[model samples]
Target chain A: MALLKIRNLTVRFATSTGSFTAVDGIDTEVDRGEVLAIVGESGSGKSVSMLAVMGLLPDTATITADEMSYDGHDLLHMTKAERRQLIGREITMIFQEPIASLNPSFTVGFQIEEVLRLNLGMSRRDAHARALELFRQVGIPLPEEKLTSYPHQMSGGQCQRVMIAMAIASKPRLLIADEPTTALDVTIQKQILDLLMDLQEEYGMALILITHDMGVVAETADRVVVQYQGKKMEEADVLSLFEAPKHPYTRALLSALPENATGDRLPTVSDFFGEAVR
Target chain B: MSVVLEGRNITQDYHIGGGLFGASKTVQALKGVSFSVEKGKTLAIVGESGSGKSTLARIIALIDAPSGGDLLIEGQPVNIALKRPDPVLRSKVQMVFQNPYGSLNPRQKIGSVLMEPLVINRPAIAAEERRALAEAMLVRVGLGPEHFNRFPHMFSGGQRQRIAIARALMLNPSLLVLDEPVSALDLSVQAQVLNLLADLQEEFGLTYVFVSHDLSVVRYIADDVMVISQGLAVEQGKREAVFANPTDAYTRQLFAATPVTDVEAIRARVAKRQAAREAAGAPR
Candidate 1:
């Protein structure tokens, strides 16, 4: 069964000149206990599409979707109250920058526990215990000490782990990771990916992994959806999509990556993708 | 055999905490780190944050003073005299920061930013000459001269980066300290930037001290690489020698975690994973 379904979704930002569609007619689905990666470049609209489904767009932004249902709930039509209750509880998200997602004023423990108290209806003591448990689960050293420490005290990798802990703390049916490892170092990135895979397997949750990295998608994702200017160019199992990318964009992207070899000139972005969209 | 820039056992210490007596704590940023870059070549320093790679670049760029050890520019030790020495070494070395958007002044036109350096250092080059130089540099970086009037904010992230590169090369520096220059861009855009850097190096005889977190980018552009971990040089050698035959355990771990360079191998691995996923996705 599909945990989250997005059909013909589009997001428009209202500018003084004119409204522009950031995400255009993107369609995708995430089944239970599956990893679906949305791969694209900077302006490819992968982030906008997921943000639209999350009901996180600002007042100036408008969203249009044929259907966006999460766990039989109409996400697109959800009231503000309904969406607030659902977010961070039923469909949690882990952003690329963890420290930014967390509140600087509050103790890391307080923020994590706050969600549990509100969503899980747990006592303060129990919520704090759960937060600590989550920290340990995400491989953060000294969970108790880390809980009391502020987000500023922790490293980027540690803060990201805290986010993962908070994200999985609720045991949401679906998790959306938006370039979770992009800001981290390669080794830490690998570790974070491994941690996410472990958590997903344990919780049996659906995952929407949005990233610009093809290597990351291949390593973790079960399926890949290649996006170009908010359009789905190709959808296949990670292996097939990588091994035999049918889309010219995907093929060109693969060829453009720098390699550790001799006499191989790196292909320019315009070499494959048309000169300039504008 | 001529070393353009060389740092000999450089150690930078920071004194933190302040009070009545200014209680100081010694924090060593670089511990006896030494490396050299040659003319018309690229040497990449690969590390994560706080790896002291940026500190190394700063020490080489003369942006920061080293607490210990010597920095030599073309065999002359960097000192007070050499530093403000009448635009000699200033014209020889330049730095391009990681955040191209933040690096360039948003208010200034692209041409003015390029002209700023030349006007300061090469006043002998007149107004018309400066304009021509700016246009030529912009063209070299793949941006058209029509953008001379445009601000940095008008361009895409990649184009802004091109402007930054143009600014760095405006003074015709012999050595460029590229600190995570392409790490901010999308992989596709990064590829284009990487290709451009390689071309620029050959054309202008520019030596690059490229610092990056991505091993692949380092592998792509660097002729030599030094892996620094926690203020220490763990591994250093020719690109092929270090990657293909890494001596240090940390370097090996990094390589293993990173995707292998060979596309055929990566494809094969992806094929296996996809087949398994397809089978699992099927009715079972």
Candidate 2:
């Protein structure tokens, strides 16, 4: 059975101008221990769809779906208490900017310990010990000292590691990482991707990687879903998607990569599909 | 060919953490980096974050003076640390930053953003002439003249970057120091901006000192390559030579770590699968 499933999901935000559909109808499912990648450019609704699944969208946004379930439980119809119980414990997510996601007023240790104590119902002493262990597991240097430091004291890569540790504190069955390494350097990006893959294998957890980099999708994804302008352009296994993209947009995207350049001028998506695609 | 910009043994050091209670320590951010860029060519500086590539770029852009070094622009020596850089020399070099959203002023109209450089540097030019040049530059960067009235927020990331490029070109600088200028845009948008840069370089005979960690982009746009690690220039050579045969261990490791999308391999595999199916007499 699938760990998480969504069908005909739609999200519309009430902007000052008018109601804008950020995410059109889309269907997605992630089986246990599988790695799925959602690929798209900005304003493509790739992040919006995952945000809808996590119930993290703003109140101004309206969500409608024919079916949204997790482990055979209805996510859309769940009560606030039920969602609070299931979200951090079973279905956790990490955002693109780790420092902004974390609280500035609290110490890193306190925030992570709070998650452990609230979600797993551990005591303060136990939560402290567990937070230390989580930090070590995430390969943070001087875990003890780092726990006391605030988010502002850490670098981008270290902050991201803390975010990952917090997301995996309860050993979630499904982990949604939205552009996890986009803000990081290339060398640090490689390390973080390797760490995520290692942890995924060790825990056997489903990972839904939301990213725009074709290189990232090529390296980490097992299945690929190409999104364009709030819609899915194509979906296939990683090999098939790269080898023979069915949609014009996917083909153009692949061709647009720097490595695939055949001439001085690159072939952009708009070049083939025109400005209407935007 | 004339050298547009040259740096000899450039170094930057920072003194931190020494107000009253603690002892200060000097950290070397850049150590004796030297290179030169010829007119109508590009030199790419590649390194990890905190590796001092950005520090070197700042020194080159005249935004920050190196603690120790000799900077030469078109065979003229300049030391901003000792004295203020001449306005003419400053106008000879301009910089384009990485984040277009942050680089552009949100409140200013696009027309004013482009004309501000002319307004400050070439005061003798009439207001109507400055407006004309700004509109022409907007069109040159692939943006329409009608976009001049719009604010930075009204433009998309790609369009904003185009506006930024237009602003950089307004000074008509001989050299452009682009610090990861296209890293924030999407792949397609990156391609468009890169092509525009190439076009402008060809049209105006511009020299570029491009700083970026993305090797693939460096390979595409740069004529020369310099690899920085731990405040030192580990390697410097022609782009083809550096990329094909990097002698430095750090450069080799960075190349190994960067992910390259292998579409040709996948295509070969698909072709092989089809051939096997055909040999087995499978129906189409």
Per-residue error for A209 in candidate 2, Å, reads 0.3
Q: Measured by TM-score, how close is model 1 to the native structure?
A: 0.94
Q: Candidate 1 — which residues are off by over 4 angstroms?
A: A260-263, A274-278, B80-85, B260-284
Worst 10 residues of 2 chain B by lDDT: B265-274
RMSD of 1: 2.6
Give one digit per residue, the lDDT tens place, for model 1 in A1-278. Answer: 58888889888899999998888888888888888999999888999888887877788888888999987899988898999888978898899998798999999989889978988899998998788778888999989888899999999999999888888878998999999999888988989998998787677788899999888887778789988886888899876776677877887778777762245577655666674332
- TM-score of each prediction: 0.94, 0.94
TM-score of chain A of 1: 0.94
List the pairs of residues colliding in candidate 1: A239-B270
Which 10 residues in a row give candidate 2 chain A its minimum summed lDDT? A269-278
- Real A-B contacts recovered, model 1: 0.61
